[model samples]
Target: MQATEPDYKCGVEVTLEVIGGKWKGVILWHLKRKTLRFSQLRRRLPGVTQKMLTQQLRELERDGMVHREVFPEVPPRVEYSLTKTGWEVVPILELMCQWGTARLQGRQEEKEMAQAS
Candidate 1:
């Protein structure tokens, strides 16, 4: 029997299901610039456990958003990069960064005004 696809309520829900997590978006953002090895990814993403990063990368790969290539060489170098679909998510992440910066600035201004009063 063929497997059924998930029934998403909307496009937003589908996007969230694929990239809604603390680390997934960040991972994609980091990979937007260039391909990175597993150790490089780990170093770039502080506070993420190796196990969790591995799991997240696996999920991204499975979802077709991330591409992982294994090189046949000493120590078996592995690298991760964003697929075309993954690159599409970059603009959304940029918007999120803008919104977050504005929100934080607004809050800081509010705090400064209150303190001055």
Candidate 2:
């Protein structure tokens, strides 16, 4: 279904507003499985600039979709994990993943058929 408003008239738009951005959904996908230290998340998404990742993470935390924990250690360790809402988003993300996989497979088959013809 198509989202009706930029003001988040429905659940889909609200979801997109919360997770919308180049990196937010990707970050959420990674965190869906486990809590990751900042460095670990950085390593996982090597292409993301540190500044951009920091921005996205801060936004997610503000929206309550992600939890940030700080450890009182000599070096000050920090970790990021999905909150309850974030975990609930997992099924939606999974459905998107499945849809993408199917689309890719269809494209591959179409390409092969075109080449054969």
Candidate 3:
């Protein structure tokens, strides 16, 4: 049997549903540059617990935003990368990063001005 699609009210809602969580967007952002192993991702994201990261990755894979490649080896090697659909979200993530940088800069300038006054 095939899975049913989610009934989203709007595009934004659908966007948020897929990437709104604390770790999902960050995970996607990290995978934007290149494929990474689970350990590499864990190191980049300091605050995320192993269990949570695993859960988030599983969700992303299920959503078709991430591709998990497992290599046959003595132990096993798995790497994660963004899917084509995932690449489509990079521009939005970049815009969000720019907006956040601007906000931080504005706050820092405000702080300096207040200190000088």
**Candidate topping TM-score:** 3
Candidate 3 or 2, higher lDDT: 3
Indicate the TM-score of model 1.
0.91
Candidate 2: count the clashes. Answer: 0
lDDT of 2: 0.91
Model 2: residue 3 alpha-carbon error in angstroms? 23
Worst 10 residues of 1 by lDDT: 3-12
Candidate 2 lDDT over 2-104, as tens digits, reads: 9564655788788888988778988999999899998899999979999999999999999899999999998999999999989988888899889999999
Superpose all Cα atoms of candidate 3 onto the true structure and report the RMSD in Å to 1 decimal: 1.9
How does model 1 fare in lDDT? 0.95
Off by more than 4 A, model 1:
1-4
- The local distance difference test score of model 3 is 0.95
Clashing pairs in 3: none
Query: Residue-wise lDDT of candidate 3 within 37-115, one digit each (tens)?
Result: 9999999999999999999999999889999999999689999999999999999999988999999999999999999
Clash counts for all predictions: 0, 0, 0
1-117: candidate 1 lDDT, tens digit per residue: 999999888999999988999999999989998999999999999999999999999999999999999999998999999999999899999999899999999999999999999
